[model samples]
Target: MNTPPSKDALREFLASKFAEAVEQNPDAVVLYAAERAPDPKRYVKRPTVQEVAFKRELEKMRDDQADKAAPESATSVSPAIRTNQLSLDDYPGLVLPGKHNEF
Candidate 1:
């Protein structure tokens, strides 16, 4: 069996595919797809000193929003894995027909 692609490899493959699709079908209405963000240095104009300060303050304001273990973006990148904590309480009708009416 073929091994699964690593996350980075999958992302690169997707980015390339999207680029191709856009090239072939610029008029296509894409519903959902992940495209790599363009390089800020190449695309974005250099910010003024005042704009830089404003950006920093905006980031600080976003960080101040109500108590949370981490930013919402943090969990989305790599979600935590949790196991189901099943217990007898989950099945009140299950019984082996022994002690206390159950074995």
Candidate 2:
């Protein structure tokens, strides 16, 4: 299948053609329409099999990277450890015993 020319390539072609037309007719000003004429076969390029394969490979790599970057589910850790709240047992010696007589 043939693909359309990129925006940059079309812009360059238009600019070059406009410059040429202005150079040839310095005395008269005109809106150049000749460049607007379309040739279906001129601007499109066919993708080769190797190029298509490379594109698929790149897309697959991107998907893999996205999957790897996602957050892991809570099931991977120990069931005793809740995912949200911090577990006091994990840090020993940080707690103090409650005093009954202190005001």
Candidate 3:
């Protein structure tokens, strides 16, 4: 009695068969299915310097507002919206380029 073929062996056999079928019939649409690992580089969207600065400024503002609203309960707040203790810094992106500067 012959033992069953392993998954890898079966996949190889099927792939070869599909390749042969395509070779034999030029017009045939034989789907060659294979699982591929995700490429990390393809999924990454690196933020610009300006974008990073803007995000930090926004977080700092939120923390400041939260602190002012509830000084006592600020420490007792949930983990998600907790302050990151961001330092105050100049946000050039937040300022408008005009004679009357706007934030």
* Local accuracy by lDDT, each model: 0.73, 0.75, 0.76
Native-vs-model 3 lDDT?
0.76
lDDT of 1 by residue, 5-91 (tens): 999999999999998999999987557788899866656578999999999998887877633646665656332222345545556
Q: Which prediction has more favorable TM-score, 1 or 2?
A: 2
**Clash number for each model:** 0, 0, 0
Highest lDDT: which candidate?
3
Order of the predicted models by lDDT, top scorer first: 3, 2, 1
lDDT of 2 by residue, 1-103 (tens): 9999999999999999988988998766746656676656766688999999999999999999878756455245543465555665666645656633456
lDDT of model number 2: 0.75
The TM-scores of all predictions, comma-separated, are 0.27, 0.31, 0.30
Once superposed on the true structure, which residue ranges of model 2 sit more than 4 Å away at CA?
1-40, 72-103
How many clashing residue pairs are found in candidate 3? 0
Clashing pairs in 1: none
